[model samples]
Target chain A: MDLKTLTIVVVVASFILYIAIAIWAKARSTGDFYVAGKGVHPIANGMATAADWMSAASFISLAGIISFAGYDSSVYLMGWTGGYVLLALLLAPYLRKFGKFTVPEFIGDRYYSKTAKVVAVICLIIISFTYVAGQMRGVGIVFSRFLEVEILTGLIIGMGIVFFYAVLGGMKGITYTQVAQYCVLIFAYMVPAIFISVQITGNPIPQLAFGSNLAGQDISLLAKLDEIVTMLGFNAFTAGSKSTTDLLFITAALMVGTAGLPHVIVRFFTVPKVSDARKSAGWALLFIAILYTTAPAVGSLARLNLINTIQPGEVGAVDGNLKYSDKPSWFATWEKTGLLTFDDKNGDGRIQYYNDKNESFKAKADSYGWKGNELKVDRDIMVLANPEIAQLPNWVIALIAAGGIAAALSTAAGLLLVISSSISHDLVKGIIAPEISEKKELFIGRVSAAVAILIAGYLGANPPGFVAQVVALAFGLAASSLFPAILLGIFNKRVNKTGAVAGMIVGIVFTLSYIIYFKFMHLELNNADNWWFGISPEGIGSLGMIFNFVVALVVSKVTEEPPQEIQDLVESIRIPKEV
Target chain B: MSSKENREAYWKANLKLMGLLLSIWFIVSYVLGIVLVDQLNTIQFGGFKLGFWIAQQGSMYVYLILIFVYAKKMNTLDKKYGVED
Candidate 1:
């Protein structure tokens, strides 16, 4: 009937569907719970992987960043998508052949040391916790807006949903629920994008519309966008500002981290065969690419629409700006979240969203009776605000809410499973209680999942909230610690326990110190001037990974090499077939 | 070659293919998109800028291709070495 009603129906329907799948496919054994009995189809596993991989960041925040930051945001699209190549070819098949349940198990056995296993579990916990916090934040944002509930209320509901499925079904239930999530999120994302594209460029395909001319204009959409943004003192929409050094390192870090993430790599273990693992990666990216390609379109088109809406005519003309009183209802809706604010500094009752920091634009602003830029737009609001900006149906707005929630919940459930399994399977069963029964192990896994949800939810809702940028920290941690260790363990047999363990420790310490130094300890130094060789904290992980490689190599040479059996273990994982 | 020799050869070939694929992957996203973005920006492909397009959309498409291509070629390598699984 109305926007709120449709939103409830869609969101409720999806939640019921996910809970039903969780109940129907609830795990009966540890194998069933952890790896879906290792019987998932390559394609189904691929879809599930897509859902798990596309977190709130991918489904919701990415387009918003791309829309506002323009070409600077391409790092996310290319860096994340390209990592699957490494995973499918370098890691997935071998890990599947190794036949392990958890990433740390592979690390422990491959390194032939219990200490290695313990180290990996620690890293897994930290990385997964950092990641799950972002997911919780995503859930909070979606709930606070779409359902018109407090963020805490939304987070509690989200935690409850995840607890039911993740604690009950483990990876098995999470997988099926994720498949449904992918369908809902992808549909919700694309339908509005297609509508907006057509409204602006008369092209049904957003990707095609991105390249096509505007509906009544001869200039291409991107070119027009470039012209408009630069006129307002922002960087050209098609050109980017990240330094070559920073871009190189950031992209490298993100790619390695994506491959190293435990939640994603674990998905490969669900498929049946080594070949299927390989195929599954291909399928996962194919589905992921659909969203990745469309994001840039939604971003740029939405940016153009927002700019035009705010500055309706000539850029510099005072009369061109929309009267603050005449602004659209969505502006007010988002303003209530405190994400979009208007100061009307000159008290002219008009909004100006130009780059006030530009030196040259200061002269123009003074002449135009503008005290300063009067509007503050949060980068996180673009995707959620797109439907309203495009004047799309209210149902589309509701779907975006559901889509954001679905993305966050699926990713949270997946990460919770990783954390739980690492605790129950690796820590408790592998070390503390080797004689525990399967039934007991399964129960422990469920309890661990529930507990993790509570902790993650609390962290997500509390003050000093983990912003979206901390996701980069999670990636950095994974890149610096797990990726180098895992890749070296598989690709280089000479890496002994001493070396692998030393490398990970060194990597984590170095990366975290650099990140913390710039990010927190010296917040004023969080810029290119203070960065080592102009490498941002996000990109420092690549340097940390190099430290790991070098340290491991040096340590291994000075210490006793891996045992003959460990060498053979490496050789086994390297090969795809049985001896 | 002996059976062990054949397996070694298969593994070598796999490594070599992987090296080639990964290098291309590196060149496309890193070199073209970041290192040589300015030079490539001089060139245009219809409505898309060459470097920006490669960075955002093009590299992703190639990444998809690279994985599938590696899988197909590896399957043949596996079968030839009698290690299809």
Candidate 2:
């Protein structure tokens, strides 16, 4: 089959499979709707958690970010996966033992303050909304690009799929569907990676091929990549470009944020026992690691392949670059998206894709009669275009579309669940209508989920940034606001209601303001040099978390201690118990 | 069910285990990947600068091991305290 037909078939098939799962696993009660009846096996929950955790950022854009950013992209690689350790060891089992329906319920009960619960709900909405927007955006892009539909049309379709499963089956449906999604996405991701690895390095294991010497060459792949990128006035692939402080804090922020994310944490609540929660996290990371380890290989190899495509021969040679007229079909395909562009500067028919901003390369470029770099390749296209760049078969290209949609829809459904439950469970039932019936609660949950998806679809149509950057902000906010509070709630028993509320406000406000100032209000101050203490805006959340910790500790010391019942609540959550 | 003293002991053991595992987590990802990256990069291993490998690949492997270890240790602890629900 041709590319377009195969893409439509695979994507439609996956959606049909998900809808079937939703029908089969429809929730019958509040228990099933909230926690999948707490019967999910550890391994199955692990797979679901993996699918829940690996969003569009993980499936579509992580490798692309790594492909272009080179060594600095380790912030994403380590930061994202390492958080599983925190979840398994520090948070997951305890939260599972708490047996709450939502994160705010735990905060409310543990702090013994409705005010604290309300604050937690607000933070959860903001973080989840920011994250869901990126997933919705990914859905729109994959549909528009693969199916030749408008972005809004794609978004509405994506929202409809989410509403079907999420509103009907809740966590029960999402769990089984996510297990299916994890299989589809991981298969889709690894197949192309293995093929490309064999194509480039004469090895099938992408991880090993990353370290292996290029075929028919003595130099290592990283060494060759370093040499070529440096020649084009870019940093070596082996060396990171961001300042050290920023890298440290950025990685830390992402790690802590991953542990703190409500969507991922709630996955643990679906499992049967506390021990199951602990083991399930390990399984989830193992699954996630399969993709994580393979990503860097896919990244560096794609970088090498792209350069080889652009410059068919030696780098500095006059006749080395591929002529514009001889460009491949893949190049033309991406050019239609405006993501890849070629201008014939100096009237040269060949494409020159070097760093035009490099001062020293200017003279050499002028000597070669080259005016400026004439090709603009968007980083996002790296992964989307990788299979074609390597000449992989049509079926594999179609699988990439299926995988991206699975990833986006799974995560969006998860986040929207969190949003809806926060409203129906935490807001409506917990606060506004404490006397509401179970059926009414379910009705509110379904209604809120539908409403949330519509808002998310609108945001997806107009994302502030690409999938990964928007996710980075969500992580930063979660790190600053939620992680600190939850960690203290579990580890330290003395944190009072006033202290927790004060700490959360300080964290969310400080992190949000710093991010906004640099990201939107004053873009000039967003870089490493201008950053406070050499920590970029992306890394500033660690500082905000620290401020929250210090402020909470000081305030708790001066104020009245938490009530005895709240202390017992903390102690109860620490140990495993039967429901 | 366990006595107050047994429960306290179990919680303490959990804290101690978490502290040790988290320390390893911090040293590998934060220390090896960042603060000591330049120093470690001087030593090459398996076609990678030590720091770069630790940052991208090595730290993730360690994280995986840490979770499994924590889970296994917690299981035994749960059994010891009769808290394996």
Off by over 4 Å in 1: A463-467
Task: Give the alpha carbon lDDT tens digit for every residue of A502-551 in model 2.
Answer: 99999989999998888878887677667789988788888999998998
Best by DockQ: 1
lDDT (C-alpha) at residue A360 in model 1 = 88
Candidate 2 residue pairs in backbone clash: none
True contacts kept of each: 0.78, 0.80
Top TM-score prediction, candidate number:
1
* A354-380 per-residue lDDT for model 1 (tens digits): 888989888987787777788898877
The alpha-carbon deviation from the true structure for residue A394 of candidate 1, after best TM-score superposition, in angstroms, is 1.8
- CA lDDT of every candidate: 0.90, 0.90
Judged by whole-model lDDT over C-alpha atoms, candidate 1 comes out at 0.90
Which pairs, if any, clash in model 1? none
Off by over 4 Å in 2: A464-469
Query: Model 2, B36: alpha-carbon shift in Å?
Result: 2.1
Error of 1 at A65 (Å): 0.7
